[model samples]
Target chain A: MQRYFIDTAMTAAPGTTVTLTGEIAHHIVRVMRMAPKDKVELVFPHQQAYVAELTQTTPTVAARLIAQLSFNSELPVAVTIACGLSKKDKADWIVQKGTELGAQAFVFFASTYAIAKWDPKKQVKKLERLQKIARDAARQSHRLVVPEVRYQKNVTALCQLPKDQGVVAYEEAAKAGETAQLVQVTQQLKPGQRVIGVFGPEGGFAPQEVTQLNAAGFTTVGLGPRILRAETAPMYYLSALSTILELQTPVVQSAYSE
Target chain B: MQRYFIDTAMTAAPGTTVTLTGEIAHHIVRVMRMAPKDKVELVFPHQQAYVAELTQTTPTVAARLIAQLSFNSELPVAVTIACGLSKKDKADWIVQKGTELGAQAFVFFASTYAIAKWDPKKQVKKLERLQKIARDAARQSHRLVVPEVRYQKNVTALCQLPKDQGVVAYEEAAKAGETAQLVQVTQQLKPGQRVIGVFGPEGGFAPQEVTQLNAAGFTTVGLGPRILRAETAPMYYLSALSTILELQTPVVQSAYSE
Candidate 1:
């Protein structure tokens, strides 16, 4: 079944029908060519996924909620990857793969060493495309929620976001063989807490930027011994957190029961 | 300093000169526009990095090995990523990023659900491009060894590769909430042991393919709750393995002591 993230809250209870209008309706009628009686997974604002059948597809697409699905595919800890604005394709790659890896949000900020400069006039279109990629990736990955994607004008703006813990992926830390910083931080995080990890551009964060981040209470952590590229570092952080919380802890026991 | 992988065994001892010829020599002379006294890191067959100064850049490039560096960036366990053939760009992405993440080798095999078919006639050119990507990525990441890239005709050929342990990243295992299989397999691997991880194509493995892999002694493992794409799955596996064997185990204490 095809999946779409409905913008509205869950208004249709089981056995009730709801109308999906605007862009989503056009996507179903035009792109997907879906018709009446076709099935789709409709994820609502509450992150609840419901199997819905297309009741009508003419003027507007409508579907009746059949059953509520019971699965939590979100990570135990919500991860926000705050990366310095990289080149065009690299940012797109980060958004797509980060969503698939269960990231909750993505924040792109301009650091001193940022090579790609975003145009304010085209920012809307750029953000829309990135958000669409996140939605598609979330749907492809069967994620309960589509990660929120946004842009920060500078690192100063990024430092203002509210987060439980903030950390920077510093290559210097890796060079210093600082292995325990990330492990120690992730170990102390309880379920439902939020963590924001910052990464640099290809030229890397400047000394003043690092000082500002450290002053803003961001702990520096190393991914490993090898130097990961700008886009690869965020995915590495998400994977490590997943290994620590999801694999090591074993969230659900059904598979292990055997 | 710029880095280049010299294609011969380490011939010169410390404080000795080595001749660089062929493509590497061409790259150094023409592409890099290097002159005498330029510094470069020379990675040899022994997988050791040596700081070498350019002694000659005329007809052939020659450099004097100044000192033998003492850093080992290779993964504790050698991982070979055997993936089902994907689209051209995705396969390229996997090889580039996987090299940076410390994969020993890459094997692309045709699977039951493979969307991309490899032509035997073009195999040489394709393999050369991928190998070049791995080499460039290895140099950029300052790695000792450039991962070897190869192609396999089918899944049976992939199964015949000698490996201490084999695992498959199965989406079904993730759906069943199988979280501990990969962790268990990675935990039991001693240092320097070879592990091969198989991944599926866009449509994933067929039921018979799964059975075949299981019968061939490949343990099916889940990469957490959310789904990963064909290219993303292998990087996730590599990242998790690095986190386990590198960060958690504390491979080198020199960088940590400061």
Candidate 2:
């Protein structure tokens, strides 16, 4: 079923009307052409969901409640992807794929190796646009939480985020049989624990750059024996991380203590 | 150092003249502006490498061997990816990625779900082009083995490959976790044992399609939680499978050996 995200409290009462506006309204009314009485699934940012029937399709696309049905699609571990803002379509592809792989947040920081530069005047507006892309990607992928897209203005400022479990994805990660960083990560991480996975630009993270991350409590981890491109690494690790924590492990108590 | 693959027997010899041609030649001679006597690494398939010097250039590219370098980059297990071809660019991407990920061979099979079709008479020629792309990818990725690229003609014929392992990568595998069908695959596979991985269309593998594969020798394996795109699934599993077997096990001496 086509799914949408709403901020409202979900109610099970049948026939209760709910209205959707903004881009989502346009998506349902103009793009999808969902007619009256067609079924759609929607959720709030919370773990609540409602299956609804389209009752009105006017200035605002509206739907009536069918039942409250909630199932979890979020990753067991909260994965945050931090990358040097890449150019054009590569950045967009990374955000979309990262969201699909269940990244809880995305950090696009300007780095020394970063080739793409954002105009100072439009930085916030650009981020707002990227935020919408992440939201739509999360909705399209049936994710419980929309991945947050943050533009970290600069690397020094980027350094200030709370140091949770951190790993810098650099080539220096040993593949000569040291428990392969990926295997070590999967075995150690539990559900609900968030990991900050750092990705570099096309030029890769400089040796000094990785040293700075190392100083900030991030351990360098390799994906595998081969070299994956910048855009490819984040998706690769995120999928690998999500696979072990979300898909492989049986349902247990939440890893996120919050 | 510049790298190129040469089909010379003397790459195994201590000192022999070898030529780098085509793109590698243009890249070294023109783009890199490499000087004469500059050291470069050249690999000969199924043999050792030569640390060669750029002795000659111009319209033709040639190098003289200096020493035998024992550096080898081969994955422990050889994998083959069989996907229903998507767009022209997608076929190229898969081959390139499959090379980097250490695939031994590739097959673009016709399937029930494939919307893209090549002229039947052109199968040999189209696959020849794909084979070239795979060869180029192998050279670029520094793969010792340039994976074979061929047209499988049809799914049934492709699935008939008598291998120790056959896997149909289905989204259903994610939810089906730990089922009798999926649990033993990783545990049973070994290095040098050829495994076949099948992927479906963008529309996804149908239930009956799953049934067809199951009826074949193909074993269905899950690639983790989120739904991977048709292109991503083959890679995701190939990487995952590589990690499970090659990266971790010291010398796989399977515990399953009776």
Worst 10 residues of 2 chain A by lDDT: A249-258
What interface RMSD does candidate 1 have? 7.9
lDDT of each: 0.88, 0.72
Between which residue pairs do clashes occur in model 1? none
Q: Give the TM-score (vs. native) of candidate 2.
A: 0.88
lDDT of 1: 0.88
> Candidate 1 chain B: worst 10 consecutive residues by lDDT?
B249-258
TM-score of chain B of 1: 0.93
Per-residue lDDT tens digits for candidate 2, residues B31-66, read 888878788877787746668898888667778888
Off by over 4 Å in 2: A8-16, A174-179, A247-258, B7-11, B58-60, B67-72, B121-129, B175-183, B249-258
DockQ (Cα-based) for each candidate: 0.45, 0.27
CAPRI verdict on model 2?
acceptable
